[model samples]
Target: MKLVFVHDGPIFEDKDGQYYEYSYHGLYERYKYLADEITFIMRVYPVEKDTKGTKLPAEIKVINVPNFKSPSSYFLKKRIAEKNIEKQIRETDYAVLRESSCAKIALKYCKKYNKPYIYECVGCIWDGLWNHSLLGKLMAPSSFIIEKKIIKNAPYVYYVTDQFLQRRYPTKGKSIGCSNVVIDKVDESVLKKRLDKISGYHVDNKIKIGTAAALDVRYKGQEYVIKAIKKLVEQGYDLEYYLAGGNRKQSTFLKDLAVSLGVEKRVIFCGSLDAAEMPHFYDSLDIYIQPSKQEGLPRSVIEAMSRGCPVLGTKIAGIPELIEQKCLFKKGSVSAVTNSIVYILHSDLEKISIYNFQKAKKYTKEILADRRRHFYDQFLEEYRY
Candidate 1:
């Protein structure tokens, strides 16, 4: 049977016809295991394929809708995008509406065609808007209402962040809490290298703390991480902070903040790193922090955990579900974050690293794939078109 996936991300095809999607290639991997053929319906805009972007799988077919890249042209093109989405829904056997504002068009077509669809709830856009701009805040109430309606209408639901999204938007449908954070098996040599680093940990040595995210986004709390490090530094702590992801444009604001705080020398902005190179980056860290003000579930934090790095994050969204309670603190509290870091470092590095790695195993591709397959089977068994 054919599965149609709907979301708001834009994918670009390069000169070589290589598919490049930023932060959203995991969708291709997720559906590849569950369906014979898959159609991804999204807002696609073209870009010159430099050697940089990730390639999409061949088994998947892409249906491009209006990306609405130009603000002035949005409304006119959006109507056309709706038509394209309707045509695809008419052809596909089943639909998977990955929750995004873009899916409203697909939702309309699904209802009109009497098509069976499942809603995959990843996060709450309303709560997430606090990190975004004024436009997002102004649009949040309606977005929340529309999201609630969309999920309520679906015959089945799958949630990535179990507690937060499910609690806020309860639905009367078959539901499963399977996170989309997929990781391959951690290399044995990498795990051994992590152990060696911890074994040599000493009190006076410089500590390397790192976090990964698109830093330009205010809510990722890259600034707060720098502040937390500054607080620790004033108290006679010798540590350095490394920020991964985001380009020079995104780092401009953050870099200025580091300079003002006089921690510019201590903060290292490593720009963007590819997925393959991440494990080594995680291995270099003594402590990994994800100090975001909001999230569904953070894939980067889990990546660090899989690499046997001790993790600390703010108590927000689905973070508490991933790591121990002691590893979390009040959201946006610089002191609480500083205190948690100090506590984790003093408590037990080796023990926490072991616990984290073991916990990360549950999120491996093999384990999560089985869960996703079971969910798909149950849905197909219950509601077949």
Candidate 2:
């Protein structure tokens, strides 16, 4: 059987012809179980060097399509993109469409040709676009309506969040909630080490708080955390805010904000760390915060939890699903974030760490892989006949 996986990707090909994407490593291996051959239908971009992304295997075929920059550009190229997408859909035995403009276009062809397809609903288009900028906010309502309709009518659906996305975009067909985050293992020793670190915490010692997210996206809400850090510093708490992730331009913007807030010395930007280095990074933090204005069950939060780090996040999207109510604060509210940080500092750190470590075990690779396999198996069984 053949599978055509369509997404809004600008998957990179380096000078040596190696394919790369930030999160696509080992993905083709997982999908191979359901199909003999797989073709990826998305946008492709050429890069001079590898960008620290997962190198894709050479066997997978990539069909490049136009990447629209704006509404006008999209309208100009829509017909051409649809023609290519339709041709690919007709040629493949099965289809998988991730939520994007390309997916929306592909959906029309899927229904027209009576092809079997599944929708991989990841994030809320409305929240994503609305929080992006003024133009995105203007376009969000109609985009949400269209995506909701597409997801509702999909024959099979898979969501990353346990509850949030399903509620926002309900499907009448078969559906399953399985987070893409797959932890390698949950070690008791790691939790014990975290507990020891927590026990060593003293009021006089400088508290280190950190967030792992790209600096480019303003909606990630790192600025709010910076504001909260300023307030806390004024309250006489010695705090160091570490932000991990890269984007030089946005990093400069954040640095300027810190300087203006008079907390430049307290803010530390630890440029992007390698995947292997993240566990140690999480361990070094006194507290981890995901003060995002938007998210689709953030993998960084789960990663921090796996290391038994006490975590706080905004009450939005799938964040509430991962964090307890007491640890959650209102998104975009500096006061709420400040108060939550204070609460975590005053509360029993060991108990919170234990709870997070136990909660993270639910997303271990061995467990989630089985759930995903079962879902794919069922999908194949129904569609193959």
Estimate TM-scores for all models.
Answer: 0.92, 0.92
Superposing all C-alpha atoms, what RMSD in Å does each candidate have to the true structure?
Answer: 2.3, 2.2
**Residue 2 lDDT, candidate 1, scale 0-100:** 77
At residue 291, give the lDDT of candidate 2. Answer: 91
Compose the digit string of candidate 2's lDDT tens values, residues 106-180: 888888888888899989999999999999899999999988988898889999999999999999988999987
- Model 2: how far residue 49 lies from native, Å: 8.0
In candidate 1, how many Å is residue 117 off?
A: 1.4
Once model 2 is optimally superposed onto the true structure by TM-score, how far is the C-alpha of residue 238 displaced, in angstroms? 1.9
- In the range 255-369, model 1's lDDT, one tens digit per residue, is 9988999999999988777677787799889999999888888899889999999999988888998898889988778888888888988878888888889888889888888
- Name model 1 segments beyond 4 Å from true: 45-51, 69-71, 186-190
lDDT of candidate 1? Answer: 0.82
Instruction: Name the lDDT value of residue 80 in candidate 2.
Output: 78
Give the backbone clash total of model 1: 0
